[model samples]
Target: MSINARLFYVYRIVSRMYFHLSVLFVYFFTLDLPVWKIELLLGVYAIVLLLTSKLNAAMLTRMPHKQVIALGELIKAGGLAALIANEHLGILLVGQILSGLGYSLAQGTDSSLLRTIMPDMQAYKKAESGSSSYTFASFLLSGIIGSIIFNYSHEYAFWCSIGANAIAITAVLLIREPAHTNTQQEARGAKPTETSAQKFWKLYYSITRAFAMATFVGFLPYYFFTQTQVSLNIFGLILSLFTLLGFISARFIVRAGNVYGFAKIAATSALLCTASMALLGSSSYLPFGIVALAVLGLASGGVRPLTLSNLNMGEWTPTQRTALLSSMEQSFGLWNAILLIAGGFAIDSIGFQWLMLILAVVYVVLMTVGYWLYHIHTAQPTAAAEQIQ
Candidate 1:
């Protein structure tokens, strides 16, 4: 099979149900475990994710991404098995930590693998692929399936998730290791002038992309927690709005990707997220908050995959794909974790509106940096148009 085909199978299984069980398990066992404990776990989970992302990315660069990812999947399955047996809070935490690590390893690496398998630049060449629409559909599907499994048996969902990881593991084993080839750099036919300003711009864009994702996903828990006290049904409705917008937007991510280009799409998404947060923060009305959330959810769906794809296509040493990926993973995971923890506290103390406003400002600054990344990159090539194309 083509590498893409093999990896697609891997994606189908691992992506499909891994999230399903992670969330289902959390709701069933961990949701009511008290806010403080949950916050502590989130903190730990962030640290664990950073460690794993760093290790996996390093391994993939030095050796092979496929092997690293496969090992992660195997470990995940084993962890799940342990969770099934122990059924203790400690056990569940351990299981989640392991699984989170596994997820961190796979998330960005999987998309990079897909890029390796594509038919060059014409065939959706990026660190990631697909669209916002794709994410929405996948998320909606996972939630629907996961909910059904939970309704019947949460334990069954856990087992089923493990089974899915097994399938991913099996597929990972069969796939060829994607080699690092810095064609995008070479294609530019010129090296970036090592100037402070140029370096700053590159860093700026990456930070912005990361910040956008952090704000969207991180602050969400705060929003949800705030609503929990008022009415559970209202909270559920808001979540449903996020899911609905996310799924509907997924239908358009591919088109947006093609039309605006990935980086532009990501920037637009950042702006959308910022606007959503700002709007939500401004409104006391439940309907206003819900509307803002849905729009923000759609943009969040777009930005995460899009910007990560840009990072994947950067000019890292081909021999150091793993290390580069690891760095990316660490940046994303650590910040994401920090954001969640901080946002949780912000919700408990100040309230969601203020948290959103604060985050929205941050998002604007980050996205502005992202907007300039393209210009800075364009400075790299003598034959800029020919190469970037």
Candidate 2:
């Protein structure tokens, strides 16, 4: 990996560590709070994250990627520092919001920076894969360490997270900003390889995927606890298994994308996810539930790369590219906000089985969208072939 790539990898690890630890800190501290309140706080975090992405997009149009990223990291570290200093609920909420803002600002900018350093599709794939690996590792380790530290003292967790955020900020500082490109000039010269319709579908896919994941992360544990006989240890292990599968699959994204193409692979992933939901809804058997969750993880892993590759396809200026991708992320954030809050209530009232069934229906709809994407992908090449002949 290049120096830029290596630095970005370090940044991802620390970023994930900071996020996981911060959230865990808030969570363990707020054990006395109502479930709805906990969910609401998370919803607030998602909303802030989404809103900040829009603000970040506008800022990116005017500023360099490195500056935006560095500022984001520093600001996030400040939030962690606040958490370390205060135990107030209000202060914790503010810290979470700031953490969300930090992610919003840095999210698209890192990818944008990487694209500038190495514009090839392969480089982009490698960056995404490396990011996925580091993120999974960070999440796994943070969960373990955060638990240990929280047991020792919640303040210790916050202090450790602050240190991680500081290190991430330093990594961002080490990365030099890539040369500035004139967005307007590039936009004027860009060819039209993708239609507005394709762009809409890509964003839609992102939104629905986010909704599904929010439902899983926010509600699945409750589902397991209330509806199944799975022990807490088993639940944690199963969740880890999913993360592991996702990590492994994400690493092979580029090769898989090349062999099957983005849309077909995405469609297949959606189909598998649909099946996973169906299995979850229909069976309470431990083995079946494990299979369902595993399938869900595999599909999630597959579609991530597919959707990323699809979003990066088409000719656009860097500003346009980053803005559109950022918009997609914000859309995900919006969906997460909505789903986490509403799904909590729904699961509480309607029961976990029915909730999974509803998600199954949503995935069914997504499967249709995936098929449509596949059709468009196939038709584009055929239309090109005819023109060449």
Candidate 3:
């Protein structure tokens, strides 16, 4: 493997370890707060991500990718620092804001960097899939290990997250900067090949899928803790199973897409997401919920590589690619913010099961309409094709 690929693998492992650890611990740390207040923390985090993504899009052209990524890791570490320093709600909010900003900066740049350095698109896709698998592998390890660590000492778990960020930052430092061919094209005022309608559809798909996945994952711990008889260790193992499937799925989803077609894979993933949510909401039985989560894990893992492959399909300048990816991330943040805030209140009123069922219905409508619009837009031939016809 190339140095970049190896470093990227390390980065994925450590960064996702940080993420999984934080997510697992954050719930218990804020357990004293009302659920809405807890959810508000994530809502605020999403809002910051949405706003910062816009800022990153504007600044990406001016900044070195490595520098931006390194700075993001540092800021994320600082955010973890803030979280561990105090358990106060106000401090936690500050931590989340900083974390959101950092995450936004680093989110899509890795793939951009990978694309820049790797000459072959297929190679890049392989590397991307490999990195994603590494991420989920880390997720699996961290979820179980972090839970165990948290059970012993919350301070240790948070420290491990900070350490992971530190390692990631070091990895960023070692990465060699690539020639910015796409940025140079942008500098010369070359227009992107992607149309506005295409961008809209991309954002639409991103928002719907992200909202469903985020909502499901975010509240899953609470669901298992409150609604089921599962123990903390068992819950951790369940999460391990989830990420294990995700790891497996990410490895093959791209190949599956190539064979069966991306549209079919995407559509099937959406239906799976819908069914998983409905199944989860319908029954509190452990087996049923586990089955639902497994389905969700499969859907979530497969769709991500598919989406990334789709996004990387067209001829796009580096700046445009980064900006477009940022926009997708921004869309996720916007909808997730709305979901977290509204769903918090909804959870307080209607409870988790009812809220989940409502969300499942909403997802079905949103995805169906999104796919319909996408079909309409895509079915129309390009100007060149029309002229040839």
User: For model 2, how many clashes?
Assistant: 0
Task: Give the alpha-carbon lDDT of every model.
Answer: 0.57, 0.66, 0.73
- Per-residue lDDT tens digits of candidate 2, residues 1-389? 78888887888778767434423414532556555656666677688878877666567666777778878887777776665566576886787788778878887777777677667877787677668666766765665565456545656667777778778878877886666655655544544455533554455457546755665566665556446745444555566655666666666755676786654565566677778878887866778878887787777764455556555453466666677667777877887888778776776677667777887787577546754565566546555323212
- Greater TM-score among 1 and 3 belongs to 3
Which ranges in model 1 have alpha carbons more than 4 Å from their true place? 1-16, 19-31, 61-63, 79-89, 124-128, 131-136, 176-244, 247-264, 308-319, 369-389
- Pick by TM-score: which candidate is best? 3
Residue pairs of candidate 3 with colliding backbone atoms: none
Candidate 3: where is the Cα deviation over 4 Å? 19-31, 179-193, 196-205, 377-389
Using lDDT, give the best candidate's number: 3
TM-score of 1: 0.74
Off by over 4 Å in 2: 18-30, 80-89, 181-201, 224-236, 284-287, 313-315, 366-389
The backbone clash count of each candidate, in order, is 7, 0, 0
